[model samples]
Target: MTTNDNPATRSDRNVERAGKLDTATLSDALDKLGINGQCYKVKARSTDFRLAGRAWTIKYGPAANPPGTVGDYIDDVPEGAVIVLDNGGREDATVWGDILTEIAHRRGIAGTVINGICRDVALCLKLGYPIFSRDHWMRTGKDRVQVEATNIPVNIGEARVQPGDILRGDADGVIVIPHEHEDAVLEAAETIHHAEEAIREACRGGMRLDEARKQFKYHQLQTRGK
Candidate 1:
């Protein structure tokens, strides 16, 4: 079939492709990408966050009135794909809980992120599920509700993620890569990482903040191939 003949087919192919990246690789991609909501910062004490092949999403909803069971939307839990949910930034009702977390892992999903809240903390931690949520809550989602139009666009915090957009999380926070800019972002992140590292080294060597900043200007300059 010609490319123009089957649009849906192409999209499915893309989702399949994006789901294959490992948690570490995705994180590195985002660390390199470096664009997320101002509040998209990580707060967990020690998550070691890396969720690879679990792709799912939700829309912004209310805690006073959340959507439904998120399990239904998770059709394909590609090994190492992290489940990315955007609960309209609510910090009360949990869109994901322990049972869902366990299932994702069993299905081979790498990790999960709730732009809202979650429950069953003990179970999640025990299951070794790497989850990053805004806070912890004990509310059930029976009447709440869920929304996942598989491989569709969803927003988390202020970051826009398309169907195949790469999602990554670390102790620092989550960073998303627009599918179109994945490779470019990855390359930029590498350049950024190196720049930050040099600055760190300078600081360790007893350089003051201003001195380190000035020295790193050269490193930053190099990122632009200057």
Candidate 2:
């Protein structure tokens, strides 16, 4: 059967591709393609963490009269999907914490990213469950925010993320790959990765840095196409 016929195979391939790329190289590719996929301000709770997977987006809004749950959606997230939480950049409350982290880790979910804040940092770090967000706080989002929707378009650190979009994060930060541009972005990222590697090798082999960079057209790698 063709790869497209197997969802597992496709997901594996996407994760593998994303695993090989860092946010820096991916950011350059996005720049060249004129796509604003770089998530600003959002950072990993620990530099030791890394994440790569398709997005399972969740958007949050103010809770209703009686308030609502903050993280009942964990059980429904498919394995290998990055849980992208858009809490409207709220810093006062957190949409994630120890319970969610524990469950997500046990379920083999790729990771979690939030535009707002998250609590329970110690648990995530201990479990090596990657968590990226604006920052970590002890406040709970219980009665303050509620899940507005799931598997829907959401914004994280100003970057628009839609369900199934590829997200890759590292010590640098996270970048979203729109599903429609996945192929192009991956291709560009691979090309840039190889070129940069070649430049590095040439420099190590005694070639001048300037000459190597120029030979690889380094300065133009991230330039917007005409």
Candidate 3:
């Protein structure tokens, strides 16, 4: 079968499974699995938005030798991939703005995550497009910072995101699930989610909170190994 028709070749299954989960649960799963995928200091523009998809990584660095462009890579991004930008965590300059937002929105791109900052906050909020970043500012990155690489592994907050890796983000935060360990991570996250639900139900059924937690092994839920 063709690659497009082959479910095994696509990240649809993993993305679908992770789509149901939040960053919190996914973080816990990553922790349990001894994987460092939780991003730090990254907050969503709107807590109402959540995104899960393969990563399209972009790395940025200080401009040099006449400088490079801030954007221009959005056009090459595939549908359903999160635009992961590594701006070296510089909040002083913005790497994304209104024009890119409009284009990404129209193209059906999943979302954008930046280690630095983004401008045009109003447009992103109004369009309901998900943007997770250190902060938003008015200063532009043009001539200040430029694209150093595309589709390469980049650091987002403290998380190392590689191209094609699964990225799931929400109001809580963002987490990276390495492509090779997706199945294990998804299984662990789902297990943790169910266990938490069971504990909640048990408590509502008149069981003491402590007893319910103990019954469901809440402490061990996020603990590494069984």
Candidate 4:
């Protein structure tokens, strides 16, 4: 429900907007917060492409190399959006690459996270694209798989990502944070991150962990500590 209707009218994004998150920030945000309501723990890549977006998922599998490469589904991608591609755990076929990244980046797309393989690693990196895939492969999709639908429910491992759900990704992997919990998760995450930052700085300043915890109440809930 937090999905904005017009890009120009978007407000309340103080840090970085969801649609413009980079790999580091996306990862940090996920590490900072968690959706208390719902999300999925889907399959993903290690170094292929790292991405985050408002989840628009698709579930499909019937062949080794699935079709419906994400580029073909661009019409559905909103400006300043990230695309979460679910390939039903197929890891051998690659559906994303240089051309796709270029198109997406130019379209104001935030990034992409795939449940399968992605190609054009060097190209995407050069483009400063944030993409995450299960693996990289030279294989191409021949349209064997059909999108059949978009913005539909799709599962990633144990998580189900629906349209409007948040996708966060980084070197640690990707996580889908539900839209309903955005405010709570973001607020909690920000508090947790700030506390951790302070602790880290204190530790670097030669304070012992126990001493820092005693001074900052690190173990207690942030709200209570304040």
Error of 3 at 149 (Å): 0.8
Q: Worst ten-residue run, lDDT, model 2? A: 1-10
Expressed as tens digits, the lDDT of each residue in 9-63 for candidate 4 is: 1223622444344433334454445332222333334354555456655555544
Error of 2 at 84 (Å): 0.6
Candidate 1 TM-score, true structure as reference: 0.69
Q: Is candidate 3 or candidate 4 better by TM-score?
A: 3
- Give the whole-model CA lDDT for all candidates, comma-separated: 0.57, 0.88, 0.88, 0.59
| lDDT of each residue in 133-211, candidate 1, tens digit only | 7878888655665553444556666777554455555565565666577556556555555666788888898889788
* Model 4 alpha-carbon drift over 4 Å, by segment: 1-52, 63-71, 220-226
- Candidate 2 wrongly placed segments (more than 4 Å): 1-10
TM-score of each: 0.69, 0.94, 0.94, 0.72
Q: Which ten residues in a row have the lowest lDDT in candidate 4?
A: 1-10
- Candidate 1 or 4, higher TM-score? 4
Local accuracy of candidate 3 as per-residue lDDT tens digits, 1-226: 0022211114478899999998899999999999999999998999987888888888889998799888887777878889999999998999999999999999888899999999999998999999999999999999999888787778998989888899889999889899999999999999999999998888888999999888888999888887
Record all residue pairs in model 2 with backbone atoms less than 3 Å apart, i.e. clashing: none
lDDT of candidate model 1 versus the reference: 0.57
